[model samples]
Target chain A: MMPAAVAEPMNTGTPLDKDASQADLLRSARFRMEREAHWRRLDALVTRAEKGGIISLSYDETRDLVEQYRQAMNSLSVARDISLDRALVAYLESLCSRAYLVVYAPQESLGGLMGRLLTRGIPQAVRRSALPLFIGFLALLLGMAAGYRLFIEDASWFYTFVPPDLADMRTPEASANYLRSTIYGDERHEGSRLAAFSSSLFSHNTRIAILIFALGIFLAVPSFVLTFYNGLVLGAFFGMFAQKGLGYDLFAWLSIHGVTELAAIAIACAGGARLGLAILLPGRRTRRAALRHEAHDAVKLVILAGLMLIAAAFIEGFLRQLVQSPILRLTIGWGMGLFWLGWLLFSGREKKIRRGRS
Target chain B: MTKKRTRKSGPRIEQFVPPEGVPVNFTIATLGSRLGAQLLDLIITYLIVFICAAGLFYGGMLPVEAETVLIVLLAFLFRIPYYIISELVWNGRTLGKRIAGIRVININGRRLTPHQVTARNLMKEVEFFTPLTMVFAAAAMSNWGIALLLAWVLAITIVPLANRRRQRLGDMVAGTLVVNNPRSVLLPDLVVASAASVPEAEMFDFLPEHLDIYGTYELQTLEEVLRDPARRAVTAEIESIARAIVRKIGYTDPVKSGQELAFLSAFYKAQREHLEKLRLFGTRREDKFHHAEGANADTAADPVKS
Candidate 1:
């Protein structure tokens, strides 16, 4: 295959042809010469490929050819000292050197998009990678439950760890009332209209979610420690009901929406952690270069997380209420995750430009 | 199809020759190569810190705070020099890049100049600011000022990725090139039967560096072989010998086609035959050698006519 040499128009030098009118002669002659030169490079590439006994030259060769080809085009002259064929050959050789760059060329930009998804709204309508959410959801379910068992089970001292209002809500009677209000979406405030239970939960959950995103950026380690800590607290919170024989009811109440919400939080952690790793490691770039490289990828992970949060919010508001079927809730959550995964792998209109060889 | 007068006096432009430069290994730009160098720098900094700490603890010399400050200062001090020296001395690579088969060079395949090295390294500040803003935002959340700073940093970070050549702020300023350091692979000769009646290009005892003279001689010999039927069978043999000799003399680019080699072989034989005739006709050895080996072979004095 002939490698394409990206050419820029020449500003200096004699045009290949001298006979045409002076005004347009340089432009027209240069164009004609460049076109011919381009073709010649293609021929040379084919010959080099045959001689080298390789189907294609390495990416390095392709890149070099592109630069050389462009330069040769710019340096075109009417000296007749060099043939068009030689110029083309030199250009193609340069292009063959750069062919490998095409492979990793888009990684930085793609990472950027992923970062945006984790931090901002990625529109549930938009497609996203499913693996991260699935992993996150699974971790939240298993990890939080385990952490709660180890840190919060049957420990009266746990009350001292939380605020009085939150600790008071852990009592059996308060838990039952909270569950009833969450399931029916019918709890009313004692004072203002804004004091509806659903609105209160919404405001509180949004604040926590925002906190998670913000914390993730400082350094990945602290955010990670905090995420696991939250999981432990959530586990202990639910364990109180389990000990009272209300475990199944508690599961049904939280699992309806926690699947998506917790997954988003985990992904956000991963994004921030990625940035921290970039700083600690930096590899071949300076600390600054390494950070920039990692930030690009971390930002993309965060963007994906944001989309998951939006999905979680919808489930929390709508499905958490009037949907007592644990089986149906699990199925719907899993289905949404699958759809997101499929979309991420297959979104966007990818343009494939295949040039026909002469 | 424009009507034009064909001038008999004018030489054929298609036959005009051009000079070729020394061949060089082409390089590929890669993040892996770029990243590997960064890792090496970090390791060096850490190692230096370890050494200083060890000296203070074991030798009982430097104070604890002094050692701590020294470590901090060392890490900061190495950043700019590490980037510039490695890029200039080793071509965008450190020990790791050298091991990974990558090097930094100019886009023109030349060594990076000092000015180009300085320009690229100084721009490291931009890349630093990109994530620094994010760190500030995350650490001091709820501060609108921090978020604004983060946004400013993000804007600077995006510029390098948006441009072609995948250059970051530093790369744009430096004009240095990061390229693949390919394995040192030597091209084997496409051998043929050695020249006999025609004097070998190597036998001329001229410096091998003069490839243009040799290339044109071979081209002329190929024309002669095509014109004469007797030389056709040995044409490939002659061309191969000439090619091997030309390449040995550091004519980096060689004719890839077997046919082109054959043509070059014939051109060499014809030129040698012409030289032999001049020698036989009582021509001066110096004049004959000049006619045989120098530029403008076609315009050389024809001894037969004299």
Candidate 2:
């Protein structure tokens, strides 16, 4: 099975057999001897590169290493074509495989990659995800309406929509005055306590956003449901305040930071949706192939959302209560939204335009 | 005595076209090995977590509330991002993978970028731990909802088995492949000790009848013996194999007691020389049983009819 040619009954005593066999042996042996040093050299360089990275090799050696790999690959092809010793063939194959990882793998610094992903990769991915983002945004709005209607029909639905710790004094039981007081919060604890609260919220939001993205790998419906459910919780809180004639007041309280925060969540879910939709509609490509580019795009969306959440948390922590006027709060919130919309659409366009022109 | 003869165990090889466009064969890491590597990583992570908790509990330096918070935060910090940091720093190898002699690589032969590494490792959170969280969450749910959760976990578990690539969810999303890091040295040529070069070495002469009885597999086995480092130290294996070849080929020449390895070297050269001649005739004798040279003849047709 390893042979490249047909099999025949041997034992021909012709004198030509010995000379031919001798020539073949010399040819194979000489073939190995001529390149054995280079193969061995490649083996050593690859080992060092793998263990200590490409920096382990000097400039001349690095250049020599590629040449050695090319030569070894040539030897492997020759050996296979001529059908040399099995062990020799295996050795060459192994040496080449090991060398390939070191020789051809990405050798660029990771810092530059991060810089690129942030300024360009993130926006490019976000702009490409307009449909999924819209779908996610629609789901959240639909959930908000459903949650508000449910809460009005039965105040007991409040507990199901919001966690007890987060609900704090905003529950159905709390008086309107107390609910307003909690919204403005206590200015006395605005130093460390507020900072701690902001950091915790930031981490929680980031964690939830990432989870939505990860769960999207399943088919995207989970991410959609989760995003909708998140909106429901917010709606329930809004409804509880509105029932007490504090709806406008609470909108001002929440909107100061809610716009960016909510959009971040929706964007994160859209990232996950990118993956789920790929599986749902792989088109001409296999699900795996379709996922290849989408998964990366999804990660960028998640990271962008994460960065937004950080900004939202800082605004929520420091600025929301400081600016008490309802008009100013809504203005700040809408301004952040406009800023993001502009950034995502326009950040990475110039490079593409220049490239096209060139 | 019919000794156990093991054939060359061919592992799963995938052809990767590197940047230079040469198709190189990479031996894919098997599922068992990957599982073992993950298990090692989990064990190592938990050990650290356990050690931290035990120290904190015994120290009694902080209040129980503070201690609890610290323990939970420490475990989360260590367990979640451990894989990403480990793989990124080691350039696709965690300590566990390094120990297991396997490493992750980009499927399309590109460098494993940080984005791919981060996304894949983050996926470990979903694939492995989601079920644990789901168990508690589903406990309050109705029966059908619980069943749905179980089905989701089962589907995730089966993804690796769905393909020959053995890609789990993380690998699928990240576009990475795991392969065994092969290690080998090009040993000296087994044909160097032929009769033309060293008379003392090639003491055993192989007639066409003797050479034709075995083929490449047997020749390679003979080469293994000749090149074996312990061939001189442990005479039994070398003697037995040499004796088997001599008896099978009807090699009448007496092999000197100390020269069993040398005798193997000589027969190895002659057999290879005969096979090479056969190769020139476009007739490669694959093994002793390769005489079924026409259609419907498989490698399993080991009649041993000789």
Candidate 3:
């Protein structure tokens, strides 16, 4: 059966003066009758293509599809101008858009997509974002040094910088044993406790990374501030440990997972800074256009950062607590850091082949 | 062709003027609807997290450590994938957005990519979740944190209100728009029965002046009124509308009370024909008001006073 509205004739009630409306209806009815077959053919082709792939159509069917699409577009224009039927006009609009997607839109396979993202998309995006990444890292370092100096000068500065819940190890009056227990956790309940700790830490870090990335839109100030704040906390902890002569031990402990965790946060901040730079100094492109272009690379960096955070969580939870040896902890930390640096530098680079001609 | 006016207020109606055809406007979704859709999505995300946590605890598949880790990971990660996957699969519509009849669309008319979806949703963490966390988790300890969180929330909310496009920070940053999905109802053909029943003189005679007062858009609207039985139920209301139209078009003929619907129907038909005829000659009127000044210029040049 024909669709509900398309086949139905217009209800132009009898009147000689209203004969023009009747004539218009008759014209519409004739137009539909003449072109309905082509419309149906196009609809069937589109439905098949939508369900499977447009490549599934035979060569003749493909040719016919194009022909039918053009005819439908012409019919739509005519119907839109002359016919006062809203439903008919709407149907044509829907049909034309469907045909447009099938005819013009690019289709990609899942395997091809994954391959592209890994090989070219993510690495290229990261490489492009180098400037912002460096800026974010510098801001973090500045904050860390400032925080460390301030806390060392005034012990009370720790409370102002670090939230109480997160100040587990660095509290001024806490005993050495209490600080050690907070660092290594309890031996008997280590497994469960570490699990909870790492999980919470992962969530907190992920939340911060996302926030850093997002807040870059407001001229990048909040993102820079947040990254600096993260650095300040780390510095405050280091300063407090240094006073107790446990700075080296704390360094080793943090390095176990800190390499990956800190890099992830830094990468997220880089993404945010990229966005902020786009808005602040769009240069030749319009602000909107620059933002759109930058968003592509920024989003990729954020995704990579998120993946790194998961890895960090695993390392922090299980390995950091278990590996009590300072040398082993430092070795693992440096090794992982080198691996990340190497991957970022060389993972997707193209090599020139030397060919010998005989 | 009339020059387009620069919009200065309300959510931007992104006008899709096809390369060779008339402009079609898609209005950005209102804040109320967007909030409702977001609330639904948040509830769904919460439920999923709760279910997974419950499953991990009850199943006892792993030790408490592994379970705790897994649940925490799930809590942090589940919502992200939920949004990203749903939008990717459904082309910018999550289950909640689908239910609320809104969909995310790239304003530049390109298909929404996965990266765009990820960017917009990730920004939600900054715009919504981060501040929410501050308010709920850290409000008691720091008044500064509370103030900052409140300001962040207020700024994001106000951004959409102040912008012409109703774009929140996420939308602006990601360059996406949430819009009401176009819903087309199958209107029954209005010309079939009316053609056969009414006598010749019963139809109102529409002069060029009466015909010029409306275009196809208004004609279609009048057709809808005529088609709906409920609209015709109140004779007085119909008569008033009919009278208003008559006055607007400077139709001096007196309309009897019962004949208002018939007059509307007749006028709709004449206006439609006039507009279509104008279109045939390469003259297009977007609406009656769109060409009023142009029409006035033409009338002034013609030296015809009617």
TM of each candidate vs. truth: 0.33, 0.81, 0.81
**Docking quality (DockQ) of candidate 2:** 0.32
In order, candidate lDDTs are 0.46, 0.78, 0.74
Model 1 RMSD in Å is 22.6
Measured with C-alpha atoms, the lDDT of residue B210 in candidate 2 is 80
Alpha carbon lDDT at A85, candidate 1 = 23
Q: Per-candidate DockQ versus the true complex?
A: 0.02, 0.32, 0.36
Better by lDDT, candidate 3 or 2: 2
lDDT, model 2 = 0.78
Which ten contiguous residues of candidate 1 chain A have the minimum total lDDT?
A: A1-10
Please give the ranking of all candidate structures by TM-score, highest first, separated by commas.
Answer: 3, 2, 1
Q: Name the TM-score of candidate 3.
A: 0.81
- The superposed Cα distance between candidate 3 and the true structure at residue B152, in angstroms, equals 2.7
Could you give candidate 3's per-residue lDDT for residues A200-259 as a string of tens digits? 887877877888888888888988998999999899888988787788888888888898
Best candidate, TM-score: 3
lDDT at A159 for candidate 2? Answer: 96
